[model samples]
Target chain A: MDDAPAYSPTPRTRATRNRDRVRYDAATVHAILDEGRLCHLGFVADGAPVVLPTLYARVGGVLYLHGSTGAAAMRAARDGGLEVCATVTLTDGLVLARSGMHHSVNYRSVVVRGTARRVSDEAEQRSALDAIVDAVVPGRSADCRPADAKELAQTAVLRLELREVSAKVRTGGVNEEPEDLDLPHWAGVVPVTETIGAPEPDAAMAPGTPLPGYLRTFTGASD
Target chain B: MDDAPAYSPTPRTRATRNRDRVRYDAATVHAILDEGRLCHLGFVADGAPVVLPTLYARVGGVLYLHGSTGAAAMRAARDGGLEVCATVTLTDGLVLARSGMHHSVNYRSVVVRGTARRVSDEAEQRSALDAIVDAVVPGRSADCRPADAKELAQTAVLRLELREVSAKVRTGGVNEEPEDLDLPHWAGVVPVTETIGAPEPDAAMAPGTPLPGYLRTFTGASD
Candidate 1:
C-alpha cells in the first residue's frame, strides 16, 4: 500500500509471452481496475470453469464484487472463500496490419487470481456498495437512496484482495512487414473510444428536475 | 445448427435466478457474439482458473479463438481438447436506479462452455484466420495480405463448438421500488457507445496513401 510499489510476480502471474508489455507496478493495476465499470469473474463450478460479467470496485487492495444473493457464484463464495480469476479490459484502438496474421487490438488488461470471500462485515458491506456505485459514476452513491435493511439482506457482496495480479498492455500503431509496406494496403490505427450520450431523464421526474452535477461531468472513458 | 432453434439448457446452463433475463435462442446468442471483437476465455491451468482476453470470431456454430502459439491456454487446447468457457459481453447502457440495490448495467452477453481443440484442418484454419480479421472490421480479410506458411505455423487457433451456450441480457429503464419512485434521484439509462475516431496512418507509410474504402465507412458499433 505504499504510494506505488510493484507487486512481486507469482509464478502464475508472470508473463510467458510479450514479456515487455507485462507490468507489475500497483499504479498500472489500480488505474485499469478503476477505469472499468465491469469485470469478468471466472471460477470453478461443478469442476468446470464458469465466466460471468459483474460490477466491481476497488477500495485499497481489495476488489468488491456485486451480485444477487441467489447467484451461484455468490453462494459458493459465501460458504467459504471461492477461488476466482477476475479480469478487466479497456480497448484503446484497432491495430491494423498489412498482413492478416499481424492484426491485433490495442488494449490494457489486468488479471487477478485469488480467493474472494463474502463481505460479512455489515459496515464494510455498506461501504463496498457505495464504492461500487461511485466506481461507475463518482459521487453517485450519495445522490441515490441507500439500500434499506431488506434490500441489503438480498444483496451479496464479495471482496477479492489484489494479492496475485499482473497487467498486459498493447499500444502504438500498425505493425507490418518491411516488404509489405508498399503492398497497396492502407495500414493505420483506428482509435476506438467509449462515449456516453445525452442522458434520458426518468419521465416521472419533475419537468424542471436538473441534471446532477456528477451526471453533467460524467465520461465513459478515463483520462 | 437450425437458424432459430433454442438451445436446450443443461443443469449447468439453466438460470438459477432472474430467469426472465436468460435466453437460449440461437439468434440472441449469435447477435451478441458477433457484436463483440474480443472475448474472455476461462480455462483451468495448473489446477486453478485463468482468464484472458483474446480476439474471437464465429463461423457457423463454432467460435474461432486467435492467440499466439506460445500462450498457455493455446498450448493446453492444442495438446488435447481443453475444457474452456468463452464469454463475450457488449455494454449497451448504464442503468442508474433510485436505490443502490437496484443499480445494474444494460448489457448483452453470451457464454459458451465446451471443450475447445486446436483447429488442425488446413482449409478451416485459413478461413478461420480470415474470419477473425473480418470480425473486427467486415471485409478486412480481403484487403490485407493473407498469412503465409511461416505466419500460419506460428499462429495457434482454437475452435469451440456452440453446443452448451446461453445468453443473458439486461435492457431498458431503471428498476426501482414503487415507494422510491419519488426519491429525487436521476434514474434512467445513460447511452453508451463505442465510436471510432479518424484513422492515424503509420508514420512509415507514404504521405499520400489513401484511406481504404472500408476504412472510410468503418464504425465501431455494429448496426
Candidate 2:
C-alpha cells in the first residue's frame, strides 16, 4: 500500500513530501473535504494566476463546483483545460503565547490538485447539483426546488476527481520557548469557535409557515 | 487617471474590459486586504502548483505572511525566487435559490500577484509582527510580551508589495431565471454569519482577574 499507483503526469507539488504533515489516506482526506462547504480554487488564467473562493461539494471521489455562466473564472475553468488547485480551511482557535514569536492558530486544511472537466451528462449534472445542495444543508435537495432542464443547461458544473488530495492540521496549546515561559505574559489558547445564531425568519413569510426541522437541528458550527 | 502608469507587463489575469472590477486604486485594494485575516497563497513549486492556507496582515503597501520556519512552501518562497499569488475572501452569506443551478454564495475577495521577498531587516520584522498582532486583536501587541532576540531569529517573515491587486465580489439575492421565480422551491439568503462567543479564560489565569476590554470588544467574527 505504500507504493501506490501514480495518478497524473504533472509531478505532485514538492510540499507533498512532508509526509508527517500530509495525510494521503482516503478516510482522512474525505473527512476534511466532507466537512468543508467552501473551497478556494487557484488556477492560472491567461498568463497570471488567480484564486477565487467558490462553493464546492464532494460526492464519492469527485468534487463538484459550479458558478454563474458569466463568471470569467468559471468560464476559464471550463474552456482552458487548466490544472486547478483547491484548498479548504477551518480555523478552530487563536493560540496566544507568552512571546510574540510563538503565537499561532489552530486550523485544519485540505489541498487537492487535478484537471477539471465540465460535467457533460444531464443525469450526472443533476446528481452533482443535488450533492451540492445537500452539502450545505443536509436533506435540503428534497425540501427545496430542484433545477429545471433549461436552468441546468445554462449553468456549468465542473468535476475534479479527488485523486491527489492531502490534509494538514495544527492544533493544541501555545508552544513557547523554555526561556520565555517564566515571563509575566499570559500564554494559552483563546479558543476561536463558530456557531449558528437564532434564525432570522424572513419579514415577508406567510403566517402559517414554520421553519424546517433541519434548520432547528443546526445547534453549532457545521464545519 | 484612466491611463495609469504601466508596468513592464500588464496584469494578464485581469479581465481586460472589466475595469471597474479590476481595481488599480491602492485604497480599494488595501481595504479588501485589511478586512480579511486569512489568505490563500498560491505558487508553482517544483513543476505542479500548490496553495497553502496561512494567516496574513497588510500594512501600508506591503503584506506580511509567516509560517513554520521548516515548512517547505515557505522555504520555496524564501529561496526559489518564485512569484507568489495570494488571495483573501470573506463569505457574507449563502444564497439559496429556487433552482439548484442558481444557488450561490455572497462573498468579497481580493487577489494579488507579485514576487515575494524574505524580510530580513530587524525593525521591519518587528513592525510586521506588530501588524499581524494588531490585525487579529487591536492593541494586543502593546499588551503582550514582545519577541526576544533568540525567538525573533527563528521565525521567517515574507513581504509582498500590494502593487497588483484586484477584488471581485458577488452579493444579494440569487439571480434566478425569469420563469423559475414562481417555482414552489424556497428561494432566499440563508444569511451565513460568523460571530465571536464569550472568551474562555485560561485555566491557569489568576483568580478573579477581569477579562481585558479588547477581548470583550469582539462583537463580530474574526475570520
Candidate 3:
C-alpha cells in the first residue's frame, strides 16, 4: 500500500514536517479514528469558516457524522458539496516541567479533508447509523432499541470519504533543558487516564433492570 | 462587538457555513479556548489533509502553539501562509442508552480558522512560553525554571489570531424517544470528569520536598 496513489490534494501542510510525529500509514490513521468518539469538523460557510463538534463513526474508508436535520451546517453540506476538514484527538498526559517553557501535553489525533455528502439512500443511512451505534458500544445495535423510520428521518447523516488523512502523536517525559536540570523543582509526566466508573442507573429505571455486562466490561477504551 | 466587521476570504469553500453550531459570540469562543489545554489542527498538505494534536495556550486574543523548529505543519504555515482550521474539545460525560441509537457523549468544543504566523520576536516567544506554563498551573511560571535564550531558540511558536472563531457545546441527559421510556434497560449519563490526583514525588527528590499546596487544592477547573 506504500506505493498506492495518494489522493490528489493530499499535500502535507508545511508544519507537517515533524517527521518523527507524522504517521502516513493507513492503519495508524484508522486506529486513531476508531478509538475516538467525537470529531471536530471544519468547513467553509458563507464566506467565513465554521467548526462543529459532533459524534462520528468510521466504516470501511469513510466517516459518518450526524446532526439535527434542521442544523445549518448539515443543510450547507447537503445542498452544496463542501470541502470539509474534520479532526479527532485523544490527550494522554500532562507534561509538567521544572521550567515554565517546557510544560506540555501528550496526545494523538487524526485529521481528514474531503467533500461531504448527505447519506440520502435509506439503506446506506441505516448502515451508517449502525456503524455509529457500534462505534460507541460494540454489539450495541443488537441489544438496544433500533431506530425506527421516524427517528431516522429527524437526523441528517453526512459521509466524508477518508481519502486524505493523517495522524500525529506525542508521548513521554518532559524535555528539560540542560541548564535547568539542577533546579530543585520537580519535573515529570502527570499521566492523564480516562476511566469508566460504576454506572449510575437512571431514576426512572425499572427496579429489576440489571446493568449490561458490556457496560461493566469496559476498561476505559480510548473511544 | 456583534457588529464588528466579519472577516472574509477569497474563493470561499462550501464548508464555511455561518451556523449556530459553528458560530459563537466572542465570550463563548474565548471560554472554550481558555478551558482547553490542547488543540487538533487541520490543514491540507499536498492534496491530502493532515491533523496534528499539540499543546496550546491562549493569551488575550491569540493562541500559541509550539513544536520543534523542524515540524512540517509549522514550516508549511510559516513559509507559505497556509490556511488552517483548529479545534479544542472537552468531553464531560458518557451517555449510555437502552438502545444502540441513544449511545452518545456530551462535550464542549471550539473551532477556529485563520492563518498562523511564526513568533519571531524573542520577547514574544518567551511570553508565549510563559502563557503555556501558566495555562497548566496557575502560579507555575513564577515558581518554575524560566527558559534560557539558547533553549528558546530551538523551539518555534506559531500564533493564530482569534478572528474567526466559534464554539459549540452539548450538555444534558439522553434525549430518549417517548416510546422508549418504558424500555427495561437503564438510561442516564455517566458523568466523566478529569481531576488532579495526589502528586507522586520524584524518586530523586529530597525526602522533604513538600507537595505544592496548589497541586493539592485542585477544584476540577474546566480544562
Candidate 4:
C-alpha cells in the first residue's frame, strides 16, 4: 500500500458530531474501503433517496462500482453521469457501557460523495472490472477466464474519484459515565470478526482442478 | 418472534431486475434487519445524496435510528420528517466463478425506503432507546442504568415504519456459463461468517464487576 495521498474534507464531507473520530487520511479510507466486499450506494431517484448494496473497489484515488446494465441504479447513473454517495462500512465490535445512552458500535466507514461517471472506454472498463474482482479475492481474477467483448458490453461500471471523502472510525474502550461505572453491568466490547470458511467447489468442477494458491490462505483481509 | 405484517411492493419498491431473488414476505425482511446492528441511512442533503452508517433497532414494523441531536442526518429528519432509505446488508460469501464477469458476493440486504420522523413522545422514545441497546446485546438494556431525562434530551431517534420495504437475497451457487465449465479454474464459494470474540473488559472496569449472564454465549446474532 503505497502511501495514498490524503484528502482534505469538503464542506459537505465535514462530520458534525464526534469530530475526534473522523479521519481524512487516505490510508484509513482505503484500508476500510478495501476490506469490505460490498458498499451501500446511495443515489437520488425520482426526487427520493435510494440506497442499494453493491460490490465496489478502490484503485489508488478512484472507486469503481459494479452492477448490471439493466439494474435501476445503473440506468439512473447513465447518460451524463449520476451524483452518488458510495459508503463502505466494516463493523468491528459492540460497545457495551454502564449507561444505556452510551452504547454504540465500533466501526470503520468511508463515504465517497461525488458524481459517478459511467465508464465507456473499453480498456478502462476492463481494468476496473479486474480491480472489482481482485479486490474481493486478491489473485483470483487472473485464474478466472477473462471477460469477453460480449460480457464487457453487458456490465455497467461507474468510476468515482475519491476527493470529497472522509472515514469515521470508532475504536476504543467504553465511555462509561463516572456515576454509572459502579453499576452491575458489563462495560466492555464484544469483538466482531469476518472469517472465511473452507472453499466448497462447484459440483460441475473437474475433480482434477487444483485449488488455487490464493484460496488456500485467504483470510479475507487485504494484505 | 411473531410474524410481522407483510408489505405490498409499491412502484418504487418493486425491483426491476432479478425479480426472482426478491421476496415480499415479512419474515425475510425482519430476519435480515434484526440480524444487522448498523444500517446505512441515506438522505438527500442540499439536493445531493448522503449515506451514513448508524446504529438502529427494529421494534416490530418500525425501525428506530440512534444518533446525537446535533448530527447532520438527525437534524435533517427533525421537522415533518426526512425522506430516507435505510439499508442493512449482511455478506454471506465470496462467489468464485469461471468467468471474471460472473464473480459476485452472496448477500442478504433489506432496503426500507420511507420518511423518517423524529420521535417526540417520551414513552415511545424511551422504549425505542431500550430496544436499540438490547438489540446489540439481548437483555443488555435492563441491566444498565436507564436513560434519564437529560440524557434522553441529548439523544435523537428517528422512527421509520417498515411499509415500503423489500429484501434481496442471493444464496444459491455460482451462475457459471455452460461454455466456461470446461475452464480449468475452481468455481465455488468461500463462505464468510461474522463471529464474536471474547469480551474485553474496559481498563477502568471494577475488579469485582462480574461478567453479565447475557454475554456468556453471545454469538452476536439476534436472539
RMSD of each: 2.7, 5.1, 5.9, 2.8
Pairs in clash, predicted candidate 2: none
The lowest-lDDT stretch of 10 consecutive residues in candidate 3 chain B is: B6-15
> In order, what lDDT does every prediction score?
0.87, 0.68, 0.69, 0.85
Error (Å) of candidate 1 at residue A61 is 1.0
Better of 3 and 4 by TM-score: 4
lDDT, candidate 1, A1-223, per-residue tens: 6365978899998888889989989999999999998898889887889888889999988899886524667778989888999999999999889989879889999999999999988899999999999998889999999888887887889999898999999999887788988887878888999989887777877887778888888943222
Off by over 4 Å in 3: A1-10, A13-16, A67-81, A219-223, B1-32, B42-51, B60-86, B97-103, B111-124, B150-167, B195-213, B216-223
Ten contiguous residues minimizing lDDT sum, candidate 1 chain A = A214-223
Q: Rank the candidates by TM-score, best first.
A: 1, 4, 2, 3
Per candidate, chain B TM-score? 0.94, 0.85, 0.83, 0.93
Best candidate per DockQ, number? 4
What is the interface RMSD, in angstroms, for predicted model 4? 1.3
The TM-score of predicted model 1 comes to: 0.96
* Model 2, span B22-107: residue lDDT tens: 55555555677787777988876544456778678888668897654235656666675447788888777666666666666667
* Error at B141, model 2, angstroms: 1.9
DockQ ranking, best first: 4, 1, 2, 3
Candidate 1 lDDT by residue in tens digits, B28-91: 9998999999999888987788888979999889899986524667777888788999989999
Question: On residues A68-94, what C-alpha lDDT tens digit does candidate 4 reach at each position?
Answer: 524556765677778899999898999
Which model is ahead, 2 or 4, in terms of lDDT? Answer: 4
Docking class of 4: high
